[model samples]
Target: MLKIQEIREIIKLVDNSSVDEFSYEYEGSKIELKKNKGTAAPAPQMVQAAEEVKQPAQQAVQQAPAQTEAAPVQAEESKPAETTADDANLHKITSPMVGTFYKSSSPDADAYVKAGSKVDESTVVCIVEAMKLFNEIEAEVKGEIVEILVKDGQLVEYGQPLFLVKPE
Candidate 1:
């Protein structure tokens, strides 16, 4: 028989490793752990180009003619670089409280800030729903989003890094 803590440790170990399947048996008690290959890490940086609330409209109104084609290429090139940013120079937007994180004001609306989206101290970066109340989370630093650390509708813990930003 395995203790609860031991089982939890086993699960974490299996989840972080490359092994896709695991099984164990002791004293007629059996345990099995499997990683779901279908679920890509819940990171949202890959879909950033399609996100960005108030970003596209603002950019289109300002530099549409000059950036129309270049923006698409930039997005593709940045995909590879997004994974290698130096965290030492980045500002992290962390969850202020334990709650469920939401990327938009509503399900159908665009996300507040995606990779490459610029943000200021007052910018609403995400929503944290706690105790039936939706609290809007703000980005307190001025910067461009370098990565989105949390997935939409995911549970977040207090002080968990939600987004990584490169200061402007």
Candidate 2:
């Protein structure tokens, strides 16, 4: 059975993705998610089957994605806005998925980029680990990094700003 936090993370991923439906089964437990047309996020259903022949299986419809939305809201509130007049020409490098931010490929390695670091469209600026996959994030714009928006190991939401770059 999946833990509550893990389930929430899965729900967030499904919500942020374009998939219309998703299903997973493990042991006797199953999870299903289907997106509602015109809705921004999908609703998930969790099912647990009892091993004992005499006991009835239990099914639950979980609508906790609304609660999960609050976490990202709080995170955004705590993050200082980068849209000041001086930063108007700066470009933002945003996370494409929800994950843990890693400044380096490994803890002992030097950070991929930092403040004042120059980068091109293909430069791997950092990594975002999602569901055990470390996605190398590219700068996508030629510029000098002006700031590192999120700290190492921080939980980042989909489309959250990860870096600020001053375009060349």
Candidate 3:
């Protein structure tokens, strides 16, 4: 995984270059950055694209040890059966990019949402900071926030569930 500092440097270089997209791969990890031209701010957005990179099962097994360090935490994150059943009908608002999750727009501001907060598709529920740029994340689903899956400043992976909402 690329450190936040390294991502920032890449963003700086890409912002200054003529290229609108940049991609890099090392070992099994891949990073792709794209710049949206019409946005008010010219910040590069990091997006994960599906790639067909097949590796030997032996190599995959060898990498398991390095990846399994977070297994315990992941196991702990699993919801109880009852809770899982209750939330089965809920909608998940997921991260579109890998970045540090932020509950509020600024350090002094109140969080955009919390448990029981009602939101519509256009509602900004949180911010995810990538490469020093704060990107406001919309709820996308019409519902009431039932749970927050990530803590403030936590690094989140692409497609990770950030909020669970009880659909309206």
Residue pairs with colliding backbones in model 2 are none
What is the per-residue lDDT of model 2 for residues 104-128, given as tens digits with 9 covering 90 to 100? 9999999999899999988999998
| Best of the candidates, lDDT | 2
Between candidates 2 and 3, which one is better according to lDDT?
2
Instruction: Report the C-alpha lDDT of model 3 over 1-168, residue by residue, as the tens digit.
Output: 544335556767888888888998765656667777876544344532323222211122233332333533462358676767776688877664556899998889999999999999889999877666566788877989998888998987555678989998
Better of 1 and 2 by lDDT: 2
Query: By TM-score, is 2 or 3 better?
Result: 3
Which ranking of candidates, highest TM-score first? Answer: 3, 2, 1
TM-score of each: 0.51, 0.55, 0.56
Model 1 per-residue lDDT tens digits across residues 1-168: 443235445766777888887887665555555565776431111011222222321222233233333433443355466454476688877665456899999999999988999999889999987666577777878989988877899976544678888998
Q: Which model scores highest in TM-score?
A: 3
| Residue pairs in candidate 1 whose N, alpha carbon or C atoms collide under 3 angstroms | none
**TM-score between candidate 3 and the true structure:** 0.56
lDDT of 2 at 55: 17
TM accuracy, model 2: 0.55
What clash pairs does model 3 have?
Answer: none
